[model samples]
Target chain A: MERPPHFICIQLPANPEYVLIVRLAVSGLANRLDFPYEEIEDIKLAVSEACNSIIAGSPPGSLILVECDSDGKTFEILVKTQSVDENDGALVPGSEQDMGLHIIRALMDDMEYLAKPGSGAVIRIRKNMSA
Target chain B: MDIKVDKRKVEEGLGIVDILGEIDVYTSSWVKEAIAEFIKEGNYNIIINLEGVRYIDSTGLGVLIGALKRVKEHEGSISLICTNPQIKKIFNITGLSKIFAIYKSEEEALAAHKEG
Candidate 1:
């Protein structure tokens, strides 16, 4: 049997103003995990981009769910969108919004996007501890 | 996460806008507006001093790029004074280091602007 991963989740209004707070929180958490200063900055930027992506795609008054977990060797985060309109899926490749996803991909070790029409989209990113 | 823009005239028709704070999705528009307003005021030659910026995301980068494009449209030039290693890293990551004329100090950027 696998042990449960240590996780922390935060829910905030889908407003761009709250992205700075999320960046600071993730910075602190990454520091405690012994990530170097540069790596912490990487995490901060990646997480901020992920949150902003949700804010741009979803409608106003939506909520963003951020879940971060660590399993000793790697860190995983999921920025799940809530109540996103199905028709606003214009974050196609090469567009301006897609640049955020590309930045996240460059900063993190691995990433995957799960889009759920009429509901929400989930962006999952993983970073190895030793990388 | 408050952003403060300090605008000062550096030379004839030149201004230096020093942005102090994290530039993200929330605050980037403010930076963009400040630059746009400067362009509107006929200060075509501008240099953005980013020595005090602690963080910047893709939106922030986009704002700078947009400002550059606008200045170019007016036959003006824009240089960047960015000393922070992290900010430089982001610029390099986005291939903006090659696109913009980046210098280590404000004086250097001003000299470069004067040369051209």
Candidate 2:
């Protein structure tokens, strides 16, 4: 039998000021998981980039939800935001948003993107302890 | 959460911008504005000292890229001094290491500036 994953979640206004809070929270969680210093930095950067993309693409007053879970061997992060304007959340090629996505992809072991019919954009990233 | 950007002249035409603290979405604007001010004052060759920076995100990297473009228009260049392994890793992973000149110390960056 597998043990249950540890979970942590944060919800904040889609404001840039709150990004630090999210980063700190994720850092603390990763530290508790005993992630190496380098991997912890990578996780922090990936999460920050996700938040930046969501905040930039979402509509005003939008809220960002970040969820993290770890099972000692694997760590996962999910960032979600709701947007009324689909086009507003679309990633423009060669834009900063595109670059941000590239950075996240390079740092994380795996990354997936989803656009729910009415829920908006979601970015899921994962890291393996041994990777 | 907070950042401090200080600008000083290295020579008649060269200046250095020293940044301390974290550079994220919220604090990157301050860095951008400080670099813009340096360009406005006709200083082109600039060295950005990031030794004191503990964290920088893609937004912070974007600010550096933008500043590089603005300075390049004046035939100026932007060199970076970063010693932190984590910060250096970000530049390498993003392939920005190839685009910008990075040095481990201010002295080396200054020598390179003088050589040009």
For every model shown, what is its TM-score relative to the native structure? 0.90, 0.90
Predicted candidate 1 versus true structure: per-residue lDDT over B54-113, tens digit per residue = 988999999988988888888888889998898898888888899988999987987888
Clashing pairs in 1: none
Q: Which ten residues in a row have the lowest lDDT in candidate 1 chain B?
A: B5-14
- Residue A25 in model 2: lDDT: 95
Candidates, DockQ: 0.74, 0.78
Best-performing candidate as measured by DockQ: 2
Off by over 4 Å in 1: A1-5, A83-97
| Clashing residue pairs, backbone N/CA/C < 3 A, model 2 | none
Tell me the TM-score for chain B of model 1.
0.95
The candidate scoring highest on TM-score is: 1
Q: For model 2, what is the error of residue B100's alpha carbon versus the real structure, in angstroms, after optimal superposition?
A: 0.9
Model 1 Cα shift for residue A84 (angstroms)? 8.0
After TM-score superposition, the amount by which residue B71's alpha carbon in candidate 1 deviates from its true location, in angstroms, is 0.7
